[model samples]
Target: MTYRRAAIPALIGGLLLAALLWWAGSSADALRLPGSVGTLGPDAVAELQRWVAPWAYDPPSFLDAGVQGHGYVLLGDDGRDRYNGIYTAGLQIRYGAVFAAFVLGALLLIRRLPPVRGRTTAAFLALWAWGAAAGTLAAAVSAPWFIAAAGHGSHRFLPQLASVTAAGRQLPVAVSLVAAGATVLVARIAAEGASTPPRTEVPARAARLAATAGTAVIALSVVVLSYQPVAAALQAYSPDGGLLAEPGDLLRQWLLLGAWDAPAAGAVVDWLLHRASDVLLLAVVWWALSRLPGLLTRVTLPAMAAGAVGATVLGLLASQLLRIAVVQTGPQQGLLYSSAAIGNGIPAALTCGLLAGVVATAVLRLSLRGAPEPAA
Candidate 1:
């Protein structure tokens, strides 16, 4: 086999696998494993783990069931549905995508090789396929660990998300992820199977300028949307627009920013803005991780590892921010929802962050004309 073909994919697969293994450990409630401490009880801990636990995802039916109930139904007794809003992606959709990609990569690599009869080519493809699947599965399973460490959610699994705007609020973020993920998959696949197109790309200066402009646009839009309120009257909240005050004062009275001490409308605007901010910050975390190789040129591997740690840190910050922004900032109520939210968010954030870093390092190394070694 040509060295580039054999070595490049193996390296990328290794980096991807390492990231996945990190994610799986995170998913296992790395924060609250058997010895894990925190607000979550065994029951709550077990609740989120059911989704990402390793080898447990064998049956497609369980995933479908999880989606229908956790995905579509099941509001908690708290009158605010936490489960539906959290986890973000259903098990089958997220992990299934990973599994599919690995299987496809394996088949594509095998087919591209000079036609060899049966087992020899098959065995080689199987080894790489196994690597890809193992890594992707690890990341899927580890997703929860990063979420739990964030510490944002309630402790219960089936909490009610009875609020009206929440459904509207969550839709945009979910749509963004699905679209980005799909694009990444399709683009990478096309790049792999098709011949490398002629390298007539834009100059680095223009590309940097464009990236800067994109960041500025996203930032400005987020800020304006946060401050700007829609003129349409909001739907009457559950229990009849009880959001006339701060959330902590009364349970679920979360008038958001609109109903806050300010013009309830302004408060609502701020609340929405804050949600956008969390999403943007999560994006920042991802971008920062993607720059790991360039950022720490002398210590790329350690930098990748640090990217994982940083992701976990970012997830925790994001969780705290979400609690402050969305669900009422309060002292007295049960922390069930907060704990669960963190459990879900922290791991997922770390998962993405770590993946971004690994992928970044992989691409940088693979494309380098001649990478330098660290000094002795």
Candidate 2:
């Protein structure tokens, strides 16, 4: 099928799937696995209540029916059974729709673009520019909704999100666009070399080297950029923000913190250790993505997309596990519990990550399905 014809149907299908997943995730709280700390005992219940207080009119109550009501009961801000407002649901819809469009658009653009001859400087510049434009468009379309959501309860749950939400929103879109564009561009370049009459070892090796370097740069840059939020989160534990060490310090803590060495050190170490699970969770995603067949075909898209969703759920569980660990580990005699920080930060990260992952996965899968196979 022509790229456009295939892409349009795929986009529509993705949007539908995204909407379905969003509704199910938000309404059903599918990410809140049973036997999770939040659904366990009295202290856990209270903690869950406090966590939900900002968003819900009433804190979630554990329902032990072992059937339809066998989990935490969510009440909306209006005291309704559901947790989200009309505006909240609308926000999710917009997020899902825009994400699907951006992913599909990038895929379609990549498929439609002329094949690249080699690692031309012009090609790199053009791809970067296109990525920037796509990211800008996505931010423009989605930022208003996110900003609006920010005021509702996001700020309460994730202190300072309003300040950096725009950047956070833009970065993912930009990265996704750049990744998709570069993948296609590099694939085409490789194809060109393969199709040529004379296959020179040097040129092919150069192309492979360049591709590896570019991918590494992009991946490392993203990881570095992500560290800021992690650092900020770790800093929240300190009242005067004294534990507000450099990103390097936080990274060190994340990598090294094993046992409570000292009071101050233990606090930072514990916090970092908690947040570091996200890295492991992300690794799970990378592992799943890697397991996808090397061929860039439509058949594997659904599985990859499902893996994304599954990874998200796993990440949310990881966050909950962090919370459970904190409570179970008990308070260090000399250390103070930064309830404000933990209460505010973890829930925000969990909620946003869960929602964003669902939207991104749905869109990415649809985009992949819509994209045509690379020419042999």
Candidate 3:
């Protein structure tokens, strides 16, 4: 009966989720400039700004409209068509990969701890709210981090925060609505079965370790997912920030593409270092969580909360140190980067990790309540 109730919402939610993810990917592509603007002339910046204006905002000025018209003329019909096709295709691929991951992760997590009560609906909604807040907060912090990492933008914090806040306010309604609906649908589906399945038990120590690792994965995913929007905000506000404009995957190319005979080798090393930072952070979080007890039970909530906060601080410090070691940079630059990271790291981690801890606990509590105790 519960399963029957969930089907309709789940189907609708799935469709909405697809649309939202695509829109997010499209926004990323649209905000990005055609090429590096480090050496762009004033006319080129004007043209590009006019071209990107429609996506950036609405109710374009007459002058902006005129500039866009000129841009189209410059590109010509054939070039314009080709660019449009590439943009559309890039968005499709970006969203497809992310949406695939979301679906797979959602299903795996749901199956592991299937929702077994109607109250799961409320739980899902709460999780969604927490996630939204977490993303917004990450943007607030990361906006400044973007500038600091670049080392050339305004060092002022208030403007950076305001830029991110404005971007958050401008998010499309469709995206928010669809995201909320999807969360409810996930909740409904997870709670469909009322029968208490047999609870699986592992060695106490092992279960704690697994739970710790899982929590870290959840927290880290939040951090990575927020990067897209934050990056977009940077592009919007500081289009001419040179290397700052093209971080992420482009960082490797800029650093090692020259002066190295084997570009591929450089890429491999770059990838390793990038991943190593993430792994290092993950390990730190795991260690932090391990210090807490009752990892698999309701008692785990406080532990998870505290551990997550600690993990964030430790992780940030560790990553900064690693960056200094790898880059072999002077103390001044290193301190500047570290300060930027800390500025964002504390609040972002606190908000994301705490809320994640709460949500994870809620899911676990529900799952445990539904499942039967293990037999001797």
Considering summed lDDT, which 10 consecutive residues are worst modelled in model 3?
252-261
For residue 205, give model 1's deviation from the true position in Å: 8.2
Candidate 1 lDDT over 35-130, as tens digits, reads 644566665555445433432322223223443222343233332223323333333334444444443343333223311332233223233323
Model 2's alpha-carbon lDDT is: 0.35
Model 3 gets an lDDT of 0.41
lDDT of 2 by residue, 296-318 (tens): 22322332333233333333334
- 32-113, model 3: which lDDT tens digit per residue? 4555345554454444343333223222232223222223334445544444444344334433433443343233223332
Q: Residue 333 in model 1: shift from native, Å?
A: 9.4
Question: Over the full model, what C-alpha lDDT does candidate 1 score relative to the true structure?
Answer: 0.36
Instruction: Please list the C-alpha lDDT of all candidates, in the order they appear.
Output: 0.36, 0.35, 0.41
Error of 2 at 40 (Å): 8.7
How does each model score on TM-score? 0.30, 0.32, 0.35
Winner by lDDT: 3
Q: Each candidate's root-mean-square deviation in Å?
A: 16.1, 15.1, 16.0
Poorly placed runs, candidate 1 (over 4 Å): 1-43, 50-96, 99-209, 224-376
